[model samples]
Target chain A: MQIYLPIAEMAIPAESIFFVSLFVGCLSGLFGIGGGFLTTPFMIFMGVPPAVAVGTQPCQIAANGLSGMLAHLRKGHVDVKMGAVMLLGSSVGTVIGVFVFKLLKYLGQIDFAISMLYTILLSSIGLLMLYESVSKLLRKKQSVKLEFNQFKVNDFVATLPFKMRFPKSKLYISALLPIGVGFMSGILASILGIGGGFMIVPAMIYIIGMPGIVVAGTSLFQIVFTTSFATLMHAVTNNTVDILLAVILICGGVVGAQIGAVLSRRIKTTHARVLLAVLILSVAVRLSMQVFMMPDELFSTVVR
Target chain B: MRIFLVVLMVLLSAPVMAQSAVTVDLAQESIDITTGFNGADLKLFGVRDAPGRIAVVITGPQREMVVRRKQRIFGVWANLSGIKFDNVPVYYDFALEQVDGDEESEDVEARAALNIVLAQSGIGLEALHFETEENVGPDDLKVFQGALIRNKQAEGRFPEAAADITFMSDTFFKTSFYIPADVPTGEYQIKTYLIGKTSVKDVSTTNVRVGQVGFSAEIYGFAKENGLWYGLVCVMFAIFMGWLSDFIRRRL
Candidate 1:
């Protein structure tokens, strides 16, 4: 039996929708995952129009991001300079992302392309995180301390003219790195309707070799502007930002993030990644089912 | 002299009857019509004073009407009762035409007839009208109207006071009432009216109070206005948690 929701004209209950948001919020705060990866697809499954789901997911992200950023800031883990630089780059990249989005939307191939990319990117990232976490757990008995090193390579990325110093991060790297990272983050943020903090955090930690402690805070700082710009742009152009729905999700998400952040400290580092992997895999499976399984009704005519 | 006096008294008594017997009752004087974001309802009432004729002249902020449907052979294959508004303060003007029938006849016909009153205010507006029945086919009738009072000049008056209220769907609507950063805090009335053939019915009114701005306005004002502050506050909370975790780890 199919039901219709008066709010979104989609078939979903208020309780289930609340729970999905809550769960996504918890995971985001606890594991540094962008809940958009989960919430967007979940909304689609519930029959919300894609544009609305994409537009509203950022509000939820904003809630989660704010909570995480604050928590990290208080921990003395935020590198303000690095974050600012990255935000500057990401903001510029966001404009490009919007243009790219318009082009793709005009081409009418955005949905298929986004879906395919999401499936591939999420699964690969999920598997990699899962493998790393599991391996770390298995080797937990060994007290291994990896040395942090700053190495310069002979590539264009390494030799970029603008070399900047991050005193707090204790690194002097080309400004190009932060800009490149921001550009990538912006593209992903716009395309995925996420803050792109998940990718940004990992990139800062591994690629830039920033301390793990600073990763969440730095990424969140950048996310704030990226998502805010995206929200504003979507509101002005598509007028799809529903403040009512956003408020409800934010209410639940803010509470959930606080609890999740407290819980994050109790869990092992590897365990957080494992949980994130599980979430990604589940979302992927659900999305794949929609693609493979026969839909109850096929839209023969185009809506737009 | 006695017959003249008797005739004068009867004439005075008859004139008194004609003056006092007629009464006008506006029973549905004040009614409130509350609608969700996208849905619309008709605010209607009867005018008893006007015995033979009635006029409804609705005037307010200007509005527009756009209809989306499929035209079928039988007519339009859709329900045409509940009109949708993309924006708020929807205004209209309606009038009633008297036929050679009794009050009962007029009542039955009034159900099907409606006058489309356009917005008089030169504000950009849009509207969609439909019949108020379920499973019934479309009415096949279209009403195009604008505001009754339009500002002749191309310029807008009270630029700061003007606000845009847009309906997102059935339950959610957004109004960007620009309280200029410099505007003084006070109580303002937001009024909307429903105009019928001969009467003016105020449908809805809301009072908005703006308070003194302070620190909350600086950090949270922007957030409160644009709804970004909630997220910013959440981030602050997460950082606090992160700190608490680190503090605990250090002690352990």
Candidate 2:
């Protein structure tokens, strides 16, 4: 049941890889987020080299985004103009991010940096989502009505000079806001080896005032391009991508996403949000524990 | 002239006959690593003309490795410093057998005697040499080398203790060594020494060729040689699997 991974130069159990991808894929489908935040750390914990785990993830993420984007596209939920503008900014952000990643790698601090970044990102995002959901739940119990407001451009976002109209989302906002948001998400996606869906979806909702209907599809559209480009860049520059690992993950992930999408219909959105927040918080806590706790073997040897 | 030559040859052969003579051969000379290869057992048998003690040692190919020690920088553990060890054996195993002795006495004598032979012939794992990079101090070198050995032993790549060599008969003796699946494939040497009271009387050596075979080998080679192409292929494979899975899901 073990297969030899040529690039990583190690043998790992086939089923373990499949199951991890399946679980993450299910979460991605249910939450409408890329599971790279979970997959990268899990692979490292399972003994894949940190570089290979990071390098190989973009390929899997790109595939997942493509499949998910296609589903959303059929429902007329994507704004191609907005996605293109964001993608342009993402490309610039990804280049800068990859450079920083290489610098950290050369300093032998990549692992430490990655863990530190994840701890901060996941916990903050998870806590914020948890707070919002809990307050909404309380308001419902008190008979306070929740309003789905009509899309309105924020005063700060509307004032910028370069105006763009996205007909699909029925929004007229300065293009700079979306570009800035895309740039940040792109940098995060490359650095963390994630699709950055968690950050981008919320940004699209609050900052650009994009309707909820188009957010998921629009975000996924940018993710597919950014991640695919990142994968090729890492492969050519770092030579760290393990193709075998990507294939195994994609096999399970595609199927798991379908199952998750089907299951999402049965659950309430409030409950799903709470569960997702808990999962993210737990991963952050686990990562923090690893950093704070003493390791059993203080010395590690690497073959040159 | 023919009679005089025959007499000279007999005089030279007389000394070899009087003392012990040793000859050794492995059960197999080459090992093929297929996809199903987990590990393999090697059978080495040898004979001696006179009764003495025997020691067997196996050393795999040597390569450079880095040993890093994690330091508590602020609150988190990180790899602060490391030393590169040059010419370290990737795998090592040793076995010893005493012709005549009890357990307690043999343990003490065998160790004392084996050290002497190993030092002289430079044949066993203990005989291996290590050198450090320019920046590493002498004391630091010792710490790194010790850590290297300790980690390798924990990983089961190096033997913690030598196995006992069994003798099937008075003249014929044999020992078995296990090569784990994780053993790096390369040229290896199996050396058998006939140990005397003072020094090594005779030595025999055999070679083993360990390399990957079949489909796995082809893939491994491709990845190592054509890394960029390999990466491209892997990406394509991922896309294909993703597409296949999505298609299957829709049908179901």
Candidate 3:
């Protein structure tokens, strides 16, 4: 059936979008990623206005994040203090990202800039995760339990001023480290219309040196806020957020997220990381193709 | 059958468009754009005593439109120069009278005559023009205009060709306008043109309002005026929906 989206001023087939949103939501819940990296392109491909697609992504991401976060919190996986610190930094980053977005829009190059940045960000992060996860998967299983401080980056982060304890994550790192991480992710999230979970998950494991099990839940916790902030920015400034579209997305997303949360509990950490790495890499590759490929239609018309 | 009967009643109530024998009545007073609105197919049936062709034109509200052409810039397909056009009607649907069977003897000649007349009168899609204050060359403007029309046609805003205006008989004719879901809501003018073998004999017009209705309409309107509060509501509503879904899932 078709549903008319008010802000987008378009009618879309509800069933197809529901299934796609469900699939993306499952991946989000499974990996604790916001899933915006998938749905935004899907909507745009389906002929929904790009602005509306980018604007509506955050609302559904928040819903999916909340559903997944609740599951992880129940199992004591969330590091509330760490998530809060990162949230503070991301909030500032989001504001900056919005300003940068406006500047790009004024240059009449925002569309190209977004596509280029989106491809670059996704591919780099995907490669980083793929490398780390593939190395861990190939190693002897016992080394998976190696001490967290083995990475020199952790040593540098540990030596920074204003150390804060994250009891849930079992780490004592400088607050500045996570805040800086959150700040960068925040800026990227606002600019690229992603929740920054795919980036943050790797950062938590390598930079903050958090354990695997804790990374998903904490990243989701921060995601719930950053995406929510981005959502607000889209609604307030662009007025492109379609509530009906968001509702439909959430309807499918929550179910998938719940199923994913259940599956995550059964899978081994290394396998899950590898699966996530594969998923992220595939999307990145597809998006890069979009940036480089010649479009079938070379002309477009819009009314401001 | 019920929808047709309802259409009949609405048409009967519509005010007579011309003092002459020619009568044009729209099926509905206004097109209601509710949440479930996919698109609207409005019926336009009319009677013309004059011996001529029947054509109906529905023009929607005008707005400033930007037509962008893409080019390979530094090996990347990007939108390059754009031509800004003002007072461009967002919606323009035209339908010409369809000749029935056994009319092929002069169908080609009749169509050619109609095309020449329409071109001279500045009617139909081919003659579409918008006065622009941009510094673009005339050649560039023509290219951009073609692109704009092509894009709009692809979006179902403009039909690829004039819709069929079927003649119920020699005196009565009927046509319909398929207003797309993405059509901007505002006052629309529905014009019925009576054309002789070589010229327009008469024209009649009726105004119809197309505005958003129902629950979703309220949200669209609210978002336009109170962006901050609307964003807050959207965020909170999404969070509540998340919690509600989780609650339901646990029970299942």
Q: Identify the leading candidate in terms of lDDT.
A: 3
Model 2, range B1-252, lDDT digits (tens) per residue?
543443344345535655537776677776666666667887777676655678888888988887888888898888898877878888888887745554567577766875777677765556766776659777887788778888888766788877778766666677888887666888998888888775887877889987777766786687667766876776676666656655665676
TM-score of chain B of 2: 0.83
lDDT over C-alpha atoms for residue B161 of model 1: 26
Per-residue error for B214 in candidate 2, Å, reads 2.5
Best by TM-score: 3
Interface RMSD to the true structure, each candidate: 13.5, 2.4, 1.9
Give the CAPRI rating of model 1.
incorrect
Error of 2 at B175 (Å): 3.6
TM-score of 1: 0.53
What does candidate 3's lDDT look like per residue over A255-289, in tens digits?
Answer: 77777767778877677777777776777677666
**TM per candidate:** 0.53, 0.83, 0.86
Q: What is the lDDT of residue B15 in candidate 2?
A: 52
- List, in the given order, the native-contact fraction of each candidate: 0.00, 0.46, 0.74
Give one digit per residue, the lDDT tens place, for model 1 in B1-252. Answer: 533443344335534544332111111222221112121222222212212222222222423323222222232122122222232222322322333453465565453332223233221232222222223334332221121112111112123122333333321222332222222223443433333533343233344443333432342234435444444443344344434534443444
Number of colliding residue pairs in each model: 41, 0, 0
The stretch of ten residues in a row with the least summed lDDT in candidate 3 chain B is: B9-18
**Comparing 1 and 3 on DockQ, the stronger one:** 3
